[model samples]
Target: MFDWNDIRFFLELCRKGRLTEVAKALKVDHTTVSRRILSLEKQLDAKLFESTTRGYVLTQAGERLLPHAEAMESASATIQDHVGGENRNLTGVVRLGVPEGFGSQFLSKDMPSFQALHPEIELEFVANDRFVSLSKREADLSITLERPRSGRLISKKLTDYSLRLYASRDYLAKHPPIKTVEDLKDHNFISYIDELVPDPQMLYLSEFVASPNVTLKSSSIVFQFQATVAGAGISIMHCFVADEHPDLVCLLPEEIEVNRTFWLNTPEDIHDLARIKAVTQFLTELVDRQKKKLLGVLE
Candidate 1:
């Protein structure tokens, strides 16, 4: 008979790609993950991973076990949802990965309300633009600019937004007149400070700007916007974020525009928890309510 715990550990290892990464996701120690993997491999009598400094690579047996484990995950979720009866007051944590822009511009302001209404639930908002692997349980929910790779997950197009290049009104005053995209080459650029480029929006630079000379690199869009507003440099920001900030003005009104989509992503097993279901429903509703606000960001 197969030990269910072994399967669970194997599933986690396959999804996460490394004992270290899995340990961090499970909030346990690397040694624990290593022990679990070794135990599972020993029981199955198969090599499941090829360890390296970067991470673990799944072996053939590990790959073969993936679909079965995912099916089990789906089954588990279904059973839980059935037993929970779709209750609204869900207790437990719902880890949320939000782009820094949305976290600051919209979600943060309304989060208190979500907390007040659902006191039993704790919201873990991990601010990152990088698309963390949902299959690995990096987060329970994620809001991203582009659609993620399809798998055992449920996703929705939350909203369509845009990015507009802008600078502090005072900085614009100092900069040359912006009439075309070519003019932007002369100005200092502010960009998200990481090489982990999963965001399709950032990839636009590859096609548009042949050589981008970023003056400031920040991990947070809010901070990037702040720096731009303080005359640090010019940046392309979600129009909604730049619109209300009184200090910034759109540069080259017609040249710098991005048509982007906001997608809400979650694991397929999300429906199993009553609390997750409530947040999922509320999140869908929340995005629907602000359709215009998101659409206005790029225009």
Candidate 2:
């Protein structure tokens, strides 16, 4: 007989790679994860992992146990979803990772409604520019700029959004006349730091300016938006966000348009879990409802 609880820890450890990360994800102490892993190994009488300076490396036994444990996880999620009848009372934490602009400007504004409907379901939101790892359980759900290319994950195209050059009303008033993309070279630009850019797709300035005179760089798109709004410099700003701020002026909407799509992604193992399913549905509906805004079809 195996303790399903122990298997839970095992699954987390295999996914996370580090005991500390596993402990954080499972809401347990690192020692507890170590104890559970040891106990499971003792019961099975096999070394499941090789502890090294790098991290835990799964042994043959652990690798063999992985698929079985994953099947059990899927079975458990199916059972819960079926028993819950897709009810709103479904309870558990669902961590969502999203790009800073979407999370801060868009999703956070609408999340209050989700919270009102699903009071029992706790939300852990991570708004970042970096890619959150579903395989590592860093986030249960994620909104990514690009579709995930690998892993046991599921994805859906959320919506397409446009970006264009923007500057503060005051900045444009004080700067030289803008007639073409060539004029952008003389203006102060704001952009993401090259090394800190989480994905290459985020490096959008080169498309407009061959070598921009970037006066400021930030990891958060929200910050860049704010700075641009404060007359700091021009930036390639998301239409959905920049359009809302009356102080910012869109430049060359026809000639400098940049289109990008957001993708919703989740690990296959927990995709059918009641809470996850509920959130995914909510997200799909929300994006659909706001498709006009997302695609810059509205104002």
Top candidate when judged by TM-score against the true structure? 2
lDDT (tens digit, per residue) of candidate 1 on 66-102: 7787778767766765676465445677888988778
Q: Which segments of model 2 are wrong by more than 4 Å?
A: 18-30, 84-88
RMSD of 2: 2.2
Residue 282's lDDT in candidate 2: 90
Error of 1 at 144 (Å): 2.6
Q: Write the per-residue lDDT of candidate 2 for residues 1-299, one digit (tens) a residue.
A: 76788999998888878999899978989999999999999988989998888888899999998888878877887787777566457898899999989988888888889988788899998987677987766789999998988988999998888888899999999999788988888999999989989989888989878989999999889889889999999999888898888998888777898899999999987888878988999989998898878777754
| lDDT of candidates 1 onward, in order | 0.76, 0.88
Candidate 2: residue 22 lDDT (0-100):
90
The C-alpha local distance difference test score for the whole of candidate 2 amounts to 0.88
Each model's TM-score, in the order given?
0.78, 0.91
